[model samples]
Target: MKKKIINGFLQILGIMIVGAIIGYSVGKIAGDSLSKVDTPNIILLLIAGVVVFILQVIIHEAGHLVFGLLSGYKFISFRVFDFKIIKDENGKLKIRYERLAGTGGQCLMRAPEYVEGKFKYRLYLLGGVIFNIIFSIVSWLILPSYYTLLFALIGFVLAFLNLIPMGFNDGMTFYHASKDETTRFILHLQLEYIYYQSIGKNLLIEKPEIVEKINSLEITNTNYLTDALEFIKLDGLEYFFEFDALYNESRKLYIERDDLLPVYKVELMALLVKLISLVNPEDELLEELMNDKSLKVRLKQNNPQTKNILATYENGVKLDDEKALNLINEARKIKNKAPNLYIQNLEMKYCDYLENNIIK
Candidate 1:
């Protein structure tokens, strides 16, 4: 707890320092007109500030798109904070709100396969940063108006802010992922999976091939976020013991992940492992998961199927066949991210295990 708090303090300190530098630079380049804007009301200034901040975020995402396209990467989704622009069932663009912590916005690019020991993904990953810096330079060069300077300065500062390299920030993702073959492979696989899902298709992960390759790799250690995500994408449930080991390795990282969704996901995986295993879980693990504030909040906010699955785990409440079928029906009606197999399998289990039980 002390270490995490210290790290948090250090991160904040670094941001403030970097921010100060950027602010000074912006003032020198763009001047005090931005800070001392002439506005009718304070509320107008606040609203204008919000608008510019959001625009910078959009430009940052656009940077990713531009460079990703340049590098032969295809777009999957673009998110500004919780508002996502992604393809619907008909491959038409659809927008939805999905609030997440530590994410002001994002651009997801589907990468082409990496050639033997050749990684082209660093460009796509770094694309947004590269573009943000470029935009800042352009803004500085153009010597635009004070309001324009506000947009430019925000863009400049936000770009630098993303480079702090901790807690799912751009710099950290780049640092950890750079020149790492295993990590590159994980990225490749993720893109492939996302592509299949985008088209509303089930990606067939060849289990034996992937498992053998993962085993053969000379990995010193596995990253919790990357490896766990890869494992689940590759059907890790079939290899319960291996997934359990990865889960243990990634437990801390998952808990501390910037977003709350991963926390819920890992716990759900743990529960499935317990269901399949002959041995029981330590009571503490279960208690810890249940006590999670994010998971609790997430449970309340999710759609019905997600809510049901978590509810089942939380209460161990078995559903009757009639109720089980109803749940299955309801689940089919609500759309969600693909390959949520826990609910699917559990729904089937409810039918198989509970359907014929005598109710007196």
Candidate 2:
């Protein structure tokens, strides 16, 4: 607890220092431009700022896509906010709407084949930072207008934040990957696993070696990579109907991992509710999880897995079979519409399991 508090304090201090630097830069650049105007339109400036931030985010993710392709990684999906361009099962790009908590945008790719314990990783990982920095410089050099200044400033700040290992950002991943052999290997495995999922291949069955490797990793919660691998392991366990193991692991991560990502944490909590309901509907954890206002808000998303878990909870614990059936039906309807085909397949199977084996 002391360590976590110290880390949190350090992170806040770093952010404040960086913010001060960026603020001074912004003021210096914008002051000259503002001096020329009789009155500044605050609302217009605010709108422009928002637009510039979004554009920079797009540019950053695009950097990842371009560099990932160059590094021999295959594109899976690119998202800006809720809008996404994803490759469908037919190997064609399609537009979809999806949102991931704690991310402004994402660029996912199928990693190139791992050979001799190594693969191209640096370019793909640092692509966004490189792009943001390059664009910042280019934007500043091209024009001296207000929009240009904002663009340059925002881009630079984005690059800086991502280039430093603060959180689960690109810089953090790259930093760990460059230093740790295990991190690199884990990235390779994750990318390959994503590729298999994109093509409707189950790593657990067809690539049991991959599953074994993933499950063998140490879950120190020191980095997001370990947590991610553990999440994948949970999926494999769930795939084989090992609810006992799933519940225990999910509970362990949810309770023990103070550094757990919000995305993983919420999913685990929801999964726990479902598991407890299935195994022992009378478990006290169910009441607490179900009544959690924060968890309730997060679970209100349109995600298939969340809906499936909610469906199970309603059926087994609440005895609201009608609502449970509706939730499962809704999950099935949107399963194929998921950005990742692997998740789509998983949700479909889960729905089937609930209907055929559990929900009846």
Candidate 3:
């Protein structure tokens, strides 16, 4: 808690220093321009810039605070001037600020709890954008000309930019919230390309056999299917199902393929594991899958079916002791080959579950 508070304070302080420097520069420029025609007070212009900076930050962040709270999000912290950091108990963080250019501003709200479900997520995403647009229009109509016009313009620009729906910006948040299948599929493809490039592999050459197999299947618009297959391979089949539900027609193609049975069966088993885990932790099906060495080894392959199996088993253990034992057995089978510190942590958790719950 102390660390977070300190970090927030430093972030705000940094923004203040940057804002002040920019404000001073703008003040000097405006002051110089007006020197001949009545020489407007440099001090006054600087003060106005500071005021604008403060107001922009307040209104921008206020949009996030008001709308976020109104939309069922619990209020975290609200601050103005420099960078504003807000966080709920769930560790979700939102940061707000005005650009030094003084044209407009932004409030970025992150809600981890906001994941899943389309409509509620969309509201959480659009909350800040909506606030800025409404506030900008209201300011234009009611506030005095000088400051009001500036604020309105700032609001308009920021709101417009945020609605773009790309990258790490607010638009991406809106897109994800919408759960638009096409957009997600495309984004997944792009991310995959980046991932392969990062790993120094040419995706085309690296998976010629898989690509050839996909082509031989005579899939229409093979790019989409290929990408979908690849994503399933990398992330897991659950995400494939997520994408498939959006593009329901794709399911027909998968159903017709005899060679795809292994993948499909694995996915089915994974889904069943998930369902059983939800009903009871001591589900026999989950235990069977966990105890099977072949299933555990297959999971290490990082295939879509394997990923879903692991994920299902993990979620299942959270709900029941029988499931946890099953998951522990599964973990023990391939403990040496499991990837990353996360898997190591899972191993520890399974051992703890066995010791404290299974024996008892």
State, as a TM-score between 0 and 1, how close model 1 is to the true structure.
Answer: 0.74
Q: Is candidate 1 or candidate 3 better by lDDT?
A: 1
Which wins on TM-score, candidate 1 or candidate 2? 2
Best by TM-score: 2
How well does candidate 3 match the true structure, expressed as C-alpha RMSD?
18.4
lDDT of 2 by residue, 260-339 (tens): 87677777787898898777788777778878876897678787877888898888888888888899999987775565
Per-residue lDDT of candidate 3, residues 119-154 (tens digit): 234554566678777876776556434455456555
Residue 342, model 1: lDDT of 39
lDDT of 3: 0.47
Candidate 1 residue pairs in clash (backbone atoms < 3 Å):
165-172
Give one digit per residue, the lDDT tens place, for model 1 in 1-360. Answer: 687789889998988988888788767855554455453466765687899898888888898898889989877788898677876546678665454556788787778766768767777777777787787678756755655666677777788777767776677777767747777776676676656555644344433475566566666544543655544533454323344454454454444554433543645544443332212344245566556675566545444435344433432334343554454445444434322233334334443332233232
Stretches of candidate 3 exceeding 4 Å from the true structure: 1-50, 77-119, 181-360
Tally clashing residue pairs in candidate 1. Answer: 1
The C-alpha local distance difference test score for the whole of candidate 2 amounts to 0.80
Query: What Cα-based lDDT does every candidate model obtain?
Result: 0.59, 0.80, 0.47
Model 3 quality (TM-score): 0.33
Ranking of all candidate structures by their lDDT, best first: 2, 1, 3
